[model samples]
Target: MLELKNINKAFGEKKVIQNLDLTIPDGTILAIVGPSGGGKTTLLRTLAGLETVDSGTFLLDGKAFDPTNTKEQEQVVGVVFQDFQLFPHLSVLENITLAPKMVLKESVQVAEEKAKKLAGQLDIESLLNQYPYQLSGGQKQRLAIARAMAMDPKVLAYDEPTSALDPALRQQVEQLILNLKAQGVTQIVVTHDLTFAETIANQLLKVEPK
Candidate 1:
C-alpha cells in the first residue's frame, strides 16, 4: 500500500497542494484527474520525488520513508514522463539498461538481461538496436515504460500517458496498465482524459486548486 499523509506544497505564493491525504492499496491503479491549474502534476511530481513537499509522510506498505530522498525514492518509485523522454542518442536497449547499470551498479550482463526481458514483455525486443527516432509513437511509449520497469520499482507512476496517442494506442496503454496490475505492480496515473481514467483506474482522485 502507498499512503500520503498531510501533504502540502506551494510555489512562492500560491499553494498547489494543501493538506492532501490519500491511500492506495497494493496492485491498485489510481488516477489523479482535475482541472488545469489544480496541481495534479504537482502531486505526481511529489510522489515521484521530483518535487519536495513542505510537510508530508509517505508510507509504503506500512513503512514510513522520506519523500525528499531522491535516491531512496528511485528504488521505490519509477516515473514515465508525459513526453516519453527516451534519450535520442541511445538505442532502445541502452536507454533501458543505463539506469540500472549506473545507479543500481548492476553488472552490464545483468542489466542487459533485465532490459531484454522488459522489452520482450512490452513487445519491443526486436527493436532493441533501434534509436528513439526510429520508433513509432506507440513504440516509444512502450520503451519509456520498459525503461521505468527496468528499475523494478514498487510503484510506477505515469504523467499524461495518453496525451499523444490515438484512440487505438490509448486502448493499448489501458490494457498494458491492467496487465501490470495483474503482475502485482501498483500504479498512479496523472491524466486529463476522464474516459481513459474511468476505464483503467481502480480508484479516482479529483484534485482542486488550493
Candidate 2:
C-alpha cells in the first residue's frame, strides 16, 4: 500500500494541500478530480518529488518513502506532467531512452529497443528523429506518455491527460490507459472528462482547495 499521512504543501503564502491523507493499494487506478487551483497538480508534483511538501510522510508498503530519494523513487513512480515537459534538445527516441539508459544504466541497444517498442505503441515511430518543437500538441502528449512508460514504473500518474487532444485522440488515449490496468500498473489520472474518469478509475479522489 501507498499511504500519505497529514500531507501539507505551501508555496510562499499560498497553501495548496493541507492535512491530506490517502492510501492506495497496489494495482489500483485512482483519479484525482476537483476545480482549478485545488491542488490536483500540486499533489501529483509532490508525489513525484517535483514540489516540496511542508509536512508529510509517504509510506510505501509500510516503509517510509522519501520524496527526495530519486534512485528508489525512479523504480516506484513515473509522472506525465501537464505541460508534457519533454527535453527540447533531444530527439523523440532520445527523450524516451535517456532515463532508461542513464538512470537504469541499460545499454544503448537495450534502451533503443525499448524506445522503439514504446514509439510503436504510441504510434509515433515515424517521428523518432524529430525534436519536441517539431511535434504537434497531441504528439507531444503521446511522447510524454511513452517516456513515462519507458521507465517501467509501478505507479503511473498523469495530469490532465486529455486536455491537449481532440475527441478522437482522447478516446484513443483513454483506451490506452484502460489497457494499463491489465498490465498490473497502478494509475493515478487527473482529467476533466468525467466519462473518461468513470471508465478508467476504480477510485476517485476530489481535491478541494485549502
Candidate 3:
C-alpha cells in the first residue's frame, strides 16, 4: 500500500499541492486526472522521487519513505515520460539493460536476459538491435515500457502515454497497460484521455491545484 499524508509542495510562493491525502492499494491501476497546471505531473514526479516535497509523508507498505533518497526510491517506482525519453544513441537492448546493469549491479548476461524477456513480453523483441530513431511511435513507447519494467518497480507511472500515438496505436497502448495489470504490475497513468482512463484505471484521482 502507498499512503500520502498531508502532502504539501510549493515552488517559491506558488503552491502546487497542499494538504492532499491519498491511498493506493497494491496491484492498482490509477489514473491521475485534472486540468492543465493542476500539479498532476508534479505529483507523479514526487512519487517517482524526482522532486522534493516541502512537507509531506509517504508510506509504502507501512514504512515511511524518504523521497530525497534517490537510490532507495528508484527501487520503488519507475516512470515513462511523455516524450518516451528513449536514449537516441543507444540500441533498444542497451537502453533497457543500462539501469539494471549499472544501478542494480546485475551482471551483463543477467541484465541482457531480463531485457530480452521484457522486450519479448512487450512485443519489441525484433527491435532490440535497433536504435530509438529507427522505431515508430508505438514501438518506441513499447521500448520505454520495457525499459521501465527492467527495474521491476513496485509502481509504474506513465505521463501522457498516448500523446504521440494515433487512435489505433493508442488502443494498442491501452491493451498493453491492461495486460500489465493482469500480470500484477501496479500502474499509475497521468493522461487527459478520459476514454482511455476509463478503460484501464481501477481508481481515478483528480488532482486539483489549490
Flag clash pairs in model 3: none
lDDT of 1 by residue, 1-210 (tens): 899999989898999988889999989999999778899988878887788899889998898877567474257778899898889999999999998988888899999999999988899999999999999999999999999999888899999999989999999999999999898889999999999999999999988766
User: Which has the better lDDT: candidate 1, or candidate 2?
Assistant: 1
lDDT of model 2 at residue 199? 81
Top lDDT model: 1
Which stretches of candidate 2 lie above 4 Å from their native place? Answer: none
Candidate 1 versus truth, CA RMSD in Å, comes to 1.3
Rank the candidate models, highest lDDT first: 1, 3, 2
Decoy 2 TM-score against native: 0.89
The runs of at least 3 residues in candidate 1 whose Cα sits more than 4 Å from the true structure, single-residue gaps closed, are: 70-74
RMSD versus native structure for model 2: 2.0
Q: Local error of candidate 2 at 33, Å?
A: 0.4
> What TM-score would each prediction reach against the true structure?
0.96, 0.89, 0.96
Candidate 2, run of 10 with poorest lDDT: 67-76
Candidate 2 lDDT over 96-209, as tens digits, reads 999898888889999999999989987899999999999988889889989998988768899999876888988888888887777677889987677788888889887776
